[model samples]
Target: MSQSPIVLTGDRPTGPLHLGHYVGSLRQRVTLQEQYRQFVMIADAQALTDNMGDLSKVRRNVIEVALDYLAVGLDPAKSTLFIQSQLTELAELSFYLLNLVTVARLERNPTVKEEIRLRGMERDIPAGFLTYPVSQTADITAFKAALVPVGADQAPMIEQCNELVRRFNNCVGKEILVEAQALIPDHGRLVGADGGAKMSKSLGNALALSADSAAIAAFVRSMYTDPNHLRVSDPGQVEGNVVFTYLDVFDPDKAAVEELKDHYRRGGLGDTVLKRRLTEHLEALITPIRERRAQFAQDPAEVMNILRQGTERAREAAAATMSEVKAALGLSYWN
Candidate 1:
């Protein structure tokens, strides 16, 4: 019988999961858990590549992110939720995969280059941060994942993974590693409240899943609308409006949102009126998440236990893949 298709995707535990994540990937993961075998990794190790000086922050955020996952309804029974650092085999596989890829190829990766530029790491990028793609290849192949949900911009990372898979298979004379396709969402990329192309915590533009009603209110009030639309009577440009972009994803009342967009385009719809509707729609989603997060936060030990069990199961899977990879490389003299 054919095995079920597996999906491997994760988040860096640098900060709380935000609305950008909710619209972009988290909501999809909750639905996907029922259809496929899923591995939700807490990418603490990957988080470290960029934040090496702040191990304490990473450790703290791991639990914080895991709570966010559980709060968002990722069932542990349906999905394997584990910490990436727990599986030492992934690092070992990464070492082997790195040899299969070249420095030039890594340097040429569009995603990595953009990240370096965005983070202003052009002058001083750590070696670990530079080779993150190879490590990601290891993460994907270790589970033989067939689907990896990524944004349009992350298509380059998926390409890099498939390249490493082909190279490894050809060199080892075995197709042990599987190539994955990117599951692109129909919705366009989410922009930050401040009108940035991306919603990021570093930029202070994201509203966290854990953000309270007051915080959400503050975010809604401060949200960027059409900069040129200084008056309610002015015809606003909806194309680049952050509030409408959010409504397109979060608000279920499509007809109402559409009418609001039309009214704004034609003039007379004020930003305050639009923001009030947005606040109501967003609160409907965030309130429940906050409640669940509060419940999970009460028992941190239970959360750790779930991760511990998941890590053990992940280790077994990673070990099996490593065994096959080592055999392919003729490094299994003892085994």
Candidate 2:
């Protein structure tokens, strides 16, 4: 109940949000809205770092992502929801923060490196793509946000941000900026339907939250379970089972899920039956969200207005911080 902390968290406006997003941060954002000063960003600029080829995709999805935020119960009155590119101060701050970090340090970032390796952009990495850590630092520090909710993989990026915070403050001989720490949730990473290490839109391995019943059925059918459990009577492994993994996060009745797990391990439950349960649970859960999204989709203008209002408020905060940053460096111009 203590709104003592300022929290910053967001998603890239590249595609419709998926279950990985909900489990990773969206659900948490809904709760944090009541207890923290939260700012949820539609990271369009960051999305563009990789999607520069089709700028239209990034622009179009900004509203889609915003709709997802609202449908997931993010109260705009309690949380500022803004588009990342609309804040000019963040761009300016990123440029200044870039001076403090080294290229080698960025290259060593496990998150960014893994992304580059995954996208096979190693041979043709854009300068913007490589410098995103600095940009993230700007995002965190601009609002003086002290807490950032992220997945386990993104915690190191927070460390990178704090390092820059200390380096800049020390250089300027003042603590004008705040250091941030990651608030990683218990259910961290949700792997893909292919049993891949992570779920992502680019990899085409995610079940989007807004997926219709047919799409949901397809994803559940495609989900990778234990490969060896070919027969209904075969004892199955649960540790790496993707269907069970989704159930663990989605199913409301833990006792039932555990009992089903026992049944699968004891060699009677079939993948079809297990997948049917998942499909049923997912449909029940997603129907209302999909309905709400449909309503919002009817009035995209309303969504844009909400974003513009939040962006104006966010911009004011960023401008205040930029003034302090400039003053710290003795760079504040006249007046």
The TM-score values for the models, in the order shown, are: 0.94, 0.93
1-335 per-residue lDDT for model 1 (tens digits): 22689899999998888988988899999999999989899999989997888989899999999999999999999889999999999999999999988888898999999988889888488889889999999999999999999999899999999999999999998899999999997776689998898889889999999989999989988898898999999999998788998888888889988999999999998999989888998899999999999999999999999999988988888899999999999999985
Q: Model 2 Cα displacement at 97 (Å)?
A: 1.6
Question: Local distance difference test, per candidate?
Answer: 0.91, 0.91
Q: What is the lDDT of residue 295 in candidate 1?
A: 97
Give lDDT: candidate 2, residue 167: 98
Residue-level lDDT for 294 in candidate 2 = 88
Candidate 2 Cα RMSD (Å):
2.1
